[model samples]
Target: MIRFENVGVRYADTAAPALAGIELTVPEGELCLLAGPSGVGKSTLLNAVSGLVPHFTGGRLTGRVTVAGRDTRTHRPRELADVVGTVGQDPAAHFVTDVVEDELAYGMESLGIAPDVMRRRVEETLDLLGLAELRERPIATLSGGQRQRVAIGSVLTAHPRVLVLDEPTSALDPGAAEEVLAVLQRLVHDLGTTVLLAEHRLERVVQYADLVVLLPAPGAAAVVGGPAEVMAVSPVRPPVVDLARLAGWSPPPLSVRDARRRAGPLRERLAGCSPAPPRQVADAEPVAVVRRLAVRRGRVEALRGVDLTVRPGEAIALMGRNGAGKSTLLGCLTGLHAPTGGSVQVGGAVPHRTAPRELVRRVGLVPQEPRDLLYADTVAGECAAADTDAGAAPGSCRALVGELLSGVPDATHPRDLSEGQRLTLALAVVLTARPPLLLLDEPTRGLDYAAKARLTAHLRSLADAGHAIVLATHDVELAAELADRVVILADGEVVADGPTAEVVVSSPAFAPQVAKVLQPQEWLTVGQVAAALDGGR
Candidate 1:
């Protein structure tokens, strides 16, 4: 059980408390979802539970916070290791070992558990998280989603009574995300583990939450209640909730199955009218061409004989399961990873042979780890450096940052910003040059709904302005809204590639929530259905 009474946290430089008067109680054996917008105190609250807020983060904490009746104020994270297992947003930062098996066992070794018990737990965790095949792989060689699972398994092996996860499924593909969520469900029901997690992808986890804790904004009072009660008034909502609202369904549905059961009449109403089709980008001039591309890392083949063509004014969504060569393909485009065979030409020049300085003006890449692109001490310094590197106007990068994510202080350290904020800053850095070709790997990993909408609009504008965009992502709803074409890859090869609606609507794994609910219909988003209804009326 976790309890917070009149809890408030304030950093040294900031005047307003990051969180204040957050009175809540999470019962034992229940999975409680901590929901809020970006820059909110969701992470701050989780830190308070694990005794990291005032201890590791160097912040002032007010009032009492207890976990399993143990006051976090008295016990440090190491002291509470057996009772609390905390997994932060960045998994690589938490890893101490190179191999998957060693990282999973490191936490238990630190706690001095019996070797037999540790081995048993390690095997169980590997099977539970679908990481049996990757147990021997190096940590650096694994994909982003694989790292996330390993980070969670390392904590789960400790068998802590309370588990605190920050964005546990953010990096996972649809299938892998379900597996992780299923593991959490089993822990809550069978093992009596208390789960307190914060996630931006509400569609994946909201249906499983036993209790919902809603933080409307920074420094505001927190709301706690049943899932439906909180979601009706919550600022952030999933596609299913939005669809219910558009269809005028009372007591908005919380899951796809629920929404589908109530969608018969609405489906009939829109039967004759088709949603407006996406703009045609395939006819535009080629911006990049790949002919039989292949990449080898060590012995593993990351990409295999991939033939593709990207054109100006096109928005391509590169999608597949974790470790499916999506990031590797993106790297091939930006010259980060040279193809072992075949040819890749961007703007009439080979990416691997192009000069680095000249490549900046021809192509840009926003990698999965946003921090990798940032090196400056402060936000303003990073913007200035981007301008200098890209040969852009003095204020161009800063202006893009302001437009994409507002209210961030220029003097704040890039390290101190939230995960979503860091990603936005890195995106601004890449966009400064206005490259003809843009590639982003998991661009909306930590963004909330509002932030995702802003990014979607900005990327759409770029595509319309004759920029070719290829983004590797697992966010299906975003693909439905922004991508003109969908390209699915599997095991280092393209499995399917076609127009967005044709590809996503036909596939079960990649279909958006609205598409699932209104099956036998071609609608892919709530906006599409809303437009159809208004036009019909």
Candidate 2:
């Protein structure tokens, strides 16, 4: 249905091609996945298919591109609207309506479809994407994942043959991501719609991908194949694949379940791979304490009277499904949102009562969205700004910023940098202040495996250095691997809090594959699982 012939694209103001000599095709109804590290032209390729590359983006395009038998250069976005629906990473950036139902109907209405057809399509989309219950909810009231689904529903209602999504599940929680993926699966199986999606979280979506297109890092080539062929041969792969490879398992497992089922002599190979248990440092003094804290957003009570405590050197993961008030609790902790009742004390000081500058020294918070913290002309400048404050020494700030950029890419614009890089930079800035407590919101949202490893290492280092770390995330793997304790919140109140292994690895809401396989064992990390398998052997 779509084909790229020797496609090479270069954005203006740069010498390198974003996409280089790409030759590929997608048959009708094929759920193709474009995978690679960031800035390797996954988005560029998707944009090419939707006529957004040379048309809206104003970039140089070479070679021929055709979608549904029409030349992409000749077919404008409006002309190809009926054939293709594209959803970018930031759903908020593309929102055209404030209500859920209205947003779903906007695209069909714009195409001049009849009212009956539009309404029918909208209802079907809402039902398929499981948005019928939220059809009348305000877009503002919906959770991040719900809004993302609404974004896809709006595009899907157009009844386009091809759906191209750029990191559609990046902002969604695990359960919500499953909902979106389930809808996509239905669309492919029931409606025969083609899907070409670009996403960084390969672990969640990799197994379902029928065709995988692996792009090389900038200035390299692209690789494409079916699931087993691509995953086995590609340079980039999920952790399970890496484990399978390292353990000498033939027909490598794509998921942990398959690995367990196929376990043989390979189990012995993984026996000695366990990481050291995360230390549980004792700090009698709690740095931050929340007691009966209540937070209200508009008419909704986002957080009820909630209590949480963080002691120096303790790492606690605050987890919940989307809209369960994890972010609201973080907001209250960081003073971004004032509590409606009760109190929140940070580093033994009341958050709302302390000055913002004083809060900076006592507590560091990396917000859910990294873009809010980045606005400098260069990556270095953003780092510099993050390191320095009103009273911090300029020399000290510059030195810290330089250290932060040690592994970051050269000449890369912070805005143009990948999600993981931006996240790393944000954390580096937060760490520059050397606060006693660090608050990280959805810290692993867009990170790939390597970046996630680095992040885990950094967090471990921070905890080892006696810093209190509070992370609000849906990443069960990170929580399992890094956190010493887990605190689960539901409807703004703490529902569970205990050892990370008990609260996260064993909890129904966030159990890792290893935990599921060895349910009674309570293994959370790959290392732990490896040790168990080895000990069994």
Candidate 3:
């Protein structure tokens, strides 16, 4: 169990407490979700639970915090490691061992568990998290989602009484996310383990939460209740809840099944109408081309006989399971990886063969690990350097960042920003080049619905202006909102590629919640459905 009594946190430089007068209790075996807008101190609250607030983070902690009756104020993270296991937003930062199997066992080894027990737990965790195939893969070679599973398995292997995760499923595809959440459910029901997580993708996890704690703003009082009660008033909610509100459904539904039950009348009313189609692709020559691309890394064939083409005014989403070659394909386009066979051309020049300066003008990439693209300590410094490197106007990157997420201070450290904010900064850096082709991997991992909407609008404008975009992501809702085409890959090959609606509107694994609720109708987003009814009215 976790308890926070009159708890507040303040850093050295700030006068106001990052968290103000928070009081809450999470019962043993219950899954407690920390919900709030970006930069609203969700991560700060999680750190408090795991004793990272005042201990390692160098922040002032007031009031009492306890986990499993152990006072975190007095206990350092190392002292509480047996009772608490924590996984932060970025998984790669937590790995000490280079190999997946070794990483999973590292936690238990530190805890001094018996070797036999550790081995058994490691195997169980690998199977539980669907990481059996990747057990021997190097942590460096694994995809972002693969690294996430390894991080979680490492934590689960320790068998701590309390589990704390920040955005645990952000990098996982739909199927893998379900597997991890199901494992959590089993832990809570079967073993009475406590789970505390902060996540932005509510649609994936809200239905499973035993309690929801809403921090409305940076210093707002905590609102604690059942999931439904909190979701009704929460500042950020999933598309399903939004649809319920728009249709006057009492006690808003949390899952797609429940919403579908109440959608009969609404569906009938819209039977005669159709949602507006996305922007038409302009008649232009191919901006980039991939022909029979085959990329081999060690023994793994990351891509095999894959083909794709992009044109100006196009937004394409590359989707697949973990290790399914989505990121590998994105790397190919950005010239990060050379193909073993076939050809890739962007702006009529081969990406892997193009000069560095020429590649900057022809193509740009915002990789899955947004931090990889960041080097400067301050936000303003980063923006200024981006402008200089790309020969763009001064303040161009800052203006683009402002459009994405407003109010990021110029002097703030890039490391201090949330995962969502870092991604925004990286995106601004890439867009500064104003290249003919743009590539983004997991573009919306940490962004909330509002920030994602802004991103959608901005990308839509770029597409309209004849810039080509490709997004390799696990966020199905994002694909529904922004992508003109959806290209799915599996086992390093393209499996499904078509218009966004046609590809995802009916698929069980890939469909967004709105589309799932209004199946057979090709409605992909809440905005589109609302606009359709509003137009009819």
Q: Please give the TM-score that candidate 3 achieves against the real structure.
A: 0.98
The candidate 1 region of ten consecutive residues with least summed lDDT is 277-286
Candidate 1 residues 65-181, lDDT tens each?
Answer: 999999998999888889999999998998999999999999999999999999999999999999999999999999999999999999999999999999999999999999999
Candidate 2 residue spans exceeding 4 A from truth: 264-276, 390-413, 529-537
Residues 1-537, candidate 2: write the lDDT tens digits. Answer: 889999999977677788888989888878898887655778788999999989987789999999899999999888899999999876777789999999998988888999999888888888777788888889988776777889988998988999999988877777778888988888888888999998777777888888999985764677888866778876667667766665677667776678777654554444444545667679669989998988888877889878888898999988887788988888788788888998999877888778997888888898867888777877667655764562455545445434443345435677776666677677766777778889998887666666677678877888888999999888887888888888888777888988887676556658865565444455566676556556657
Cα lDDT tens digits, model 3, 16-99, are 678989999999999998888887889999999999998998888999999989999999999999999999999988989899
Tell me how candidate 3 scores on lDDT: 0.92
**Regions of model 1 farther than 4 Å from truth:** none
Q: List the residue pairs that clash in candidate 3.
A: none
- Give the winner by lDDT: 1
TM-score attained by model 2: 0.92
